[model samples]
Target: MKNRIQKLTAIKNAKKVDAFLITSLASLKYLSGYFFYFEHGLSPFQLLPAALVVGVEQQASLVLADNETQQLAFIDPSISVKTYESYVYQKPIDHTTQFLLQLGEAFKQAGIKSGRLGVELNALPASLAFFLTAQYPAIELVDISAEIAHLRIIKDEDEIASIRRAANLSDIGQAAVLRLAKTGMSELELFNLVRREIEESVGTRVPLMADFVSGTATATGGGLPTSKIINDGDLILTDFTPCLNGYWGDSCSTIVMGTPTMEQRSVFNLVKEALEIGIHSIQPGVQAREVDFAMRQHLQAKGNFGHHGGHGVGVIYHEEPRITPYNTMALQPGMVIALEPAVYSADYGIRLEHLVAVTNDGCEVLTKFNHCFQQGI
Candidate 1:
């Protein structure tokens, strides 16, 4: 994470800011190497983690609640940490005020008391924003959200490793679907089987999903499976996304319950070709749109391409450099991407997806699952 700070120092230089406040969870997690989860509606107002502050001249600090201070020992022992007490009605301590004061103190100690500051303004909560501006009227806070997001576009070594683990988990899910999916199984039953296998392999519950689309469900663009039973000759599509640690992995495979027909095989092959060609177009220094244009143009000539060719995958499932017609961002080493090309019809949709990392010369396929049409159950 220290290396991450050094890399982000360039952002400070580019933005002409003396320091930066990282409030976005994605950026914070990227800098701190810690990922925590809270219930949907129980965060911030009910619970909140600290924001990360980085000064060009000072060590980075994680500003969190007092109760979470103990976690600093494990989260990042070397980084500085400042904490404020949790809110309590009886105790009546102003936690927000405390956080602001502590944060201001951190800035003062870092010699950034009266300098321009770069911050993720979009992630800054309204209450905190009001308090911060009211307290530190002299501080010049510049929005650096796009700067940090661009820095995250190309992942570092540690991020790649975590993503590899997440990719492996997704492969485990695809394998489970191939092994457990059988004729006459309820769509819900298939969904449960894949989820059970994935959790068992991961050794703990995660925020993961294996959407079950079978028979007529395939034509509807996929969803959470129902009690509808899968039948022979049915097309089943499983788009498994497994959350391993903080990284996300995605895999989409469309398989048939029985021997596939000639038309099915042709469509699958066409989609696979498009996916492979897109992957082949990925290399350092190439415009990201070339891959999209090649795949979309090829699919367009043959039939129809309904989705973007690929997209960057990391802390957030969908991030920068989406492989779309208008995206001209150059592909760089360390960018992990997923390429999925499909042909959707009323009867069914056949899509094959693979995760790959851009290399200096070409790209490395991160997903190890066999996407080829399986002849037997």
Candidate 2:
């Protein structure tokens, strides 16, 4: 934790900022160790109350609603914590107003009254941006979103452990799909059953994203679960991404309900080979685009696959170090990425994905699940 603050402090001189006001949920969780409830559909107003203030001269601090004081336990003891009241019926001022007022105190206490402040221009709320400029007319706010994102691209030990746990949960979901999916089951039923199995493993509700499609639907690339029925000889493509412990896990597999035809087996083998080729290309100092090119070149003769080869996975499901034809970012140790190779047609489609962590010499495949159809065995 101290090292992260020092690294941010090192950037202050170059960016010409005295302190940083971290508003993005990912940044806050990464720097302060406080995992904010960042579920989707929450209004921006609800997200305005959390911030992490780190100054070059003074101590680091966190600002949040008083109701969230318990989060202090998770934060470093060296950093100060400030809070405002929340969930009150008869308050002298509204919640946003109180939050802004308390935030001003946090900034002032951090010795950020003047000079420049590094802010996440993309993630900061318009209201908060206005408040900062209006309150401190002398202070200049610089956009440091890109720098922060670059720092998060590399997973520290703590982050790697969290992702490993999340990946295990993903494996659990895939197992459920393989063990429970049967002929005549609706897509939605199988999706629900898989979700239930994941949540049961974690002992709590988990935020999940998925592509649950079967038969002809898989040919469309991917989609949400529907009432489509699974039948004998139909292929089921299951791509599940479950967020647990503030980290995300991604896994995908395609299985046939009954015995597969020669054509189905051929396409599945081609895609599986493409995925293996992509994984083998992952090594330290390798360019991300090279990985994409290798996989795309292997499947070009088939002419049925399109989409990125893979992408970095951490706090965000799909982030930097993108494995596309255009990206030139080099793969490094501690980088966790998901690579998916697919073949789509009007009749059926097959996609196989694996989550891997770049190692000093090679890569470690985090996903452990069988890649076979039920009846093929």
Q: Which candidate is the best by lDDT?
A: 2
lDDT of 2 at 118: 92
Query: How many residue pairs clash per model?
Result: 1, 0
- lDDT against the true structure, per candidate, is 0.78, 0.83
Q: Which stretches of candidate 1 lie over 4 Å from their true place?
A: 38-47, 66-74, 87-98, 375-377
Best by TM-score: 2
lDDT of 1 at 150: 88
lDDT of 2 at 276: 92
Give lDDT: candidate 1, residue 102.
77
Q: Would you estimate the TM-scores of all the predictions?
A: 0.91, 0.94
Which residue runs does candidate 2 get wrong by more than 4 Å?
Answer: 1-3, 43-49, 69-73
Model 1 gets an lDDT of 0.78
